[model samples]
Target: MTAPLPPLVRLPLLALLIDAALVVLFVLIGRASHNEGLLGTLVTLWPFLAGLVGGWLMIRAWRAPFSIAWTGLAVWAATVVLGLLLRVASGQGVQLSFMIVTTIVLGVFLLGWRGVVLLVGRARVRRAALLATAKRMSTAG
Candidate 1:
């Protein structure tokens, strides 16, 4: 029987899945806005997907999957830059307006979740510290 992976190993996988899903959601929204059909979703999505995987590999995101600064920024950059470049190479449209929208939307979707996680983690730590301080004060009083 195979042993289950530890939390450290599992977390990166979860992060990658979340990132990929958000990228897909980005593509879906864009395609839907254009009145494009689901049949061409993969056709439209591959460059961005390729870029996302490349980003994860380039930054070794597995090392710090939840680090918004470390992992999220690199992933967002690679997804946008490479995705756009690949689209140009693949003879897809690369208009200024589209590029702007792509950059903004992908940035939000990719980094937004990580930002929330970071904030939540910070809040939890702060709450814990406050509780500890309160407990200490009560005990001393």
Candidate 2:
């Protein structure tokens, strides 16, 4: 059997999965707000999902899924644009208010997690550096 992948390798894959889940969450929340049936999930899901896939493919997101500026922005843009376009082509409503709401909410969902990850990673690095410096000083003194 192949050895388990390292955490570093697994992280990007995890990020992709998170992004997809967030997109689905966005759809579900909107549908619920509108009193739409859960049975109609796929009808609402495909457009945003397609846009999400397009975003991932366009940026080769696996290469840098942790990057907010790189992966997050591109993914947000593609998902919103394509989702809107597909919604129109599919004869769904596309009011200005809905467009604004979708853009803001998806931006927060897609990019917010990445921002949190970046902050956590930075904190860990700083803590490690401080510990190392303290150790060196103690040993020297």
- lDDT string, candidate 2, 1-141, tens digits: 999989877987798789899999998888887666866777888889999998899888888898999889999999999989998999888899989999999999999999999999999999999999999999999
What would the TM-score be for candidate 1 when compared with the true structure?
A: 0.92
Error of 1 at 93 (Å): 1.3
Model 2 residue 82 distance off true place after TM-score fit, in angstroms: 0.9
TM-scores, all models, native as reference? 0.92, 0.90
Instruction: Please give the lDDT score for candidate 2.
Output: 0.91
- Provide the overall lDDT of each model, using Cα atoms, as 2-decimal numbers: 0.93, 0.91
Superposed model 1: Cα runs more than 4 Å off: none
Report lDDT (Cα) of residue 38, candidate 2.
67
Kindly report which residue stretches of model 2 are placed more than 4 angstroms away from their true locations once superposed.
1-9
lDDT of 1 at 111: 91
